[model samples]
Target: MTPQDAQAFLDENFAPWVRALDLTFTDLGQGTATATMPITDQTTRMGDILSGQALAAMADTIMVFACFAHYGEVKPVATTNLDTVFLRPGVGTHIRCEAEVVRAGKALLFTKATMFAEPSGKAVATATATFYLA
Candidate 1:
């Protein structure tokens, strides 16, 4: 799917809280998508650093969009499993999430995402996810 299409999908389908992150799709291809989520005070806890949970959520959300792009459009998909690791606190203007589909089968899909703080380009979090496609 095109980046425009992916943005439209995000606008239409994602929950309000997810949408509140103000994620913007910057690039999209057959099986990959790159998104940016700006860090705000409300999104942080106390240290002015981006929260790990927020980063994980953004990574998972980007992977779902990447899978949709791979499939040509939005199909019914559910997260079967998701694992995220927080490597460091994200302290930057924004975080970038690059998601790619590792494998796509008839009934399942495997994907991964890396979240990095821009400018510094430090890896803040990583996630692997399994989705059940319907």
Candidate 2:
């Protein structure tokens, strides 16, 4: 999928909270998606560090979009399981998310994502998720 396609997918399919993150679609190709969430006070938990919840949600959303990219269309999918690990605090202008599909079967899709704090280029979080496709 092209970046424009990815942006349209996000605009059409994501939830309000996901939209509040103000994620910008950067790249979309080869069953993968890259997006950026600009850091703001609203996105931080405390002490000017990005919230883990936001990171997790962003990762999950990216995976959903990645599935759309691969399928060449939008589809209904529910998160069956989501596992996330917070590696470090993010303090930068923005957070970058890279999501890739590990596998996609008839009933389920598996994906993973890594979130990084730009400028510093530190990995802030990682996530793996299972989505039940309908």
Candidate 3:
């Protein structure tokens, strides 16, 4: 999808609260998606590092988008399980996340994501997620 279409999807489909993260879809394609989440003071923890919560949220959101790309449309999908590992403290103006689907089944979809602090290119977080696709 084009950037405008991706942005419009984010504007229309996501919850107002999820939209609060201000995620921007940078690249969208079948089985793969990339997004950037701007990091302001509100997104940081005590050390000014990106909050784990934000990273997880971004991972979850991007995986959904990855599914959209995979199927060429957004289906009614819900996150069933999500796990994230912190690799390092995030240090950057934004967090870039890339997600890809490992498997897509009749009732389930599996996706994994890697998050990095841009400009620094340091890996900060990784996530695996399961979604129930209706």
What's the true lDDT of residue 77 in model 2? Answer: 86
Indicate the worst ten consecutive residues by lDDT in candidate 2.
5-14
Worst 10 residues of 1 by lDDT: 1-10
User: Candidate 2's C-alpha lDDT?
Assistant: 0.89
For candidate 3, lDDT tens digit of each residue in 67-123? 888888767889999999999998888999999999999999999999999889888
TM-score of each prediction: 0.96, 0.94, 0.96
Off by over 4 Å in 3: none
Candidate lDDT (C-alpha), each: 0.91, 0.89, 0.90
TM-score-superior candidate, 1 or 2: 1
Ranking by lDDT: 1, 3, 2
- Which has the greatest TM-score? 1
| Residue 54 lDDT in candidate 1 | 88
Clashing residue pairs, backbone N/CA/C < 3 A, model 1: none
* C-alpha RMSD of each candidate structure in angstroms: 0.9, 1.1, 1.0
Tell me how far the alpha carbon of residue 58 in candidate 3 is from the true structure, in angstroms, after superposition. 0.4
Residues 15-104 of candidate 1: C-alpha lDDT, one tens digit per residue: 999999999999988889899999899788788989877888898899999899888888888999999999989988999999999999
lDDT of 3 at 97: 94
Tell me the lDDT of model 1 at 129.
99
Q: Comparing 1 and 3 by lDDT, which wins?
A: 1
